[model samples]
Target: MKHYLLAVQIDETVPEPEDELREQLARTAKVSDEIKAAGAWVFAGGLLPSHASTVVRPGNGTTTMTDGPFAETKEQLGGFWVIQCEDLDEALAWADRCALACARPIEVRPFDDVV
Candidate 1:
């Protein structure tokens, strides 16, 4: 089985309704349970807003630090899931569930296989 990364993209500034958020959380829990039951789940989680990021770069043996994420964009990676699947199609199915649960976009990518 190959490992795929399922990334969830969300608008950091948008505040969802309390009821809607609750619904989303419930849906996500259900999806997580499904993934686990399928033995595809490796890891999954949500993340803090991009504003909480810190960037560090090294130049000429010196390290420079910056506040906030590397890029300022309308859509940021809000969370992700690492899952082992048979193929891209299976991964896409999982991504679809994630998108529906979170009401956001999900990007699915496979990790390179090296033995």
Candidate 2:
């Protein structure tokens, strides 16, 4: 099996109400449980807002750190799930469910096999 990353894309500009967010989290948790039951779950988690992120960049001989995401976009990676799948098709299937549960876009990408 190959590993895939299902990235949740969220638009930060639009604020989610507390009640709605609670419902969405409940749905997402259900999907995560399903993935675990299917033996496909490797790991999954939600992330703090982009403002809580720190970006580190390499310079000439040192590194510089910034206090936000690498990109300045309203849509950012909100969370992710790493799962083992038979192929791209299977991974996409999971992404479908994940997107529905979270009511957000899901970006599915496979991990490089070569170490």
Candidate 3:
């Protein structure tokens, strides 16, 4: 089995209403349960707003810490699921369900294996 990251992207400019957010969370939980039952769920979690993020960069001989994400974009990574699947096709199928449950775009990326 290969590990893949199913990332949920959110448009931070728009805010989800309280009721909608609750519903989305419930749906997401249901999906998570389904994944776990299938034995593919490694781990998953949601994230705080991008404004709360800090970036650490390495310089010549020291490191610089800055507020915010590495890039300035309307969309940011809101959550992610690390899952083990047979191949990209399986990962993409899982991403589709996750996108529906969270009402956001899901990006599927395979993790690099140690040589």
Winning model by lDDT: 2
> Candidate 2, which ten residues in sequence have the lowest lDDT sum?
66-75
Q: Model 3 misses residue 77 by how many Å?
A: 0.5
Off by over 4 Å in 2: none
TM-score of each: 0.92, 0.97, 0.97
Candidate 3 residue-wise lDDT, 1-115, digit = tens: 9999999999999979999999999999999999999999999999999999999999999999999999999889999999999999999999999999999999999999975
| lDDT digits (tens) for residues 8-55 of candidate 1 | 888877887999989988998899999999999999988888988889
Q: Assess candidate 2 and give its lDDT.
A: 0.96
Better of 2 and 3 by lDDT: 2
Off by over 4 Å in 1: none
Query: Which residue pairs of candidate 3 clash?
Result: none
Stretches of candidate 3 off by over 4 Å are none
Report the candidate with higher TM-score, 1 versus 3. 3
Colliding pairs, model 2: none
Candidate 2 deviates by what RMSD? 0.7
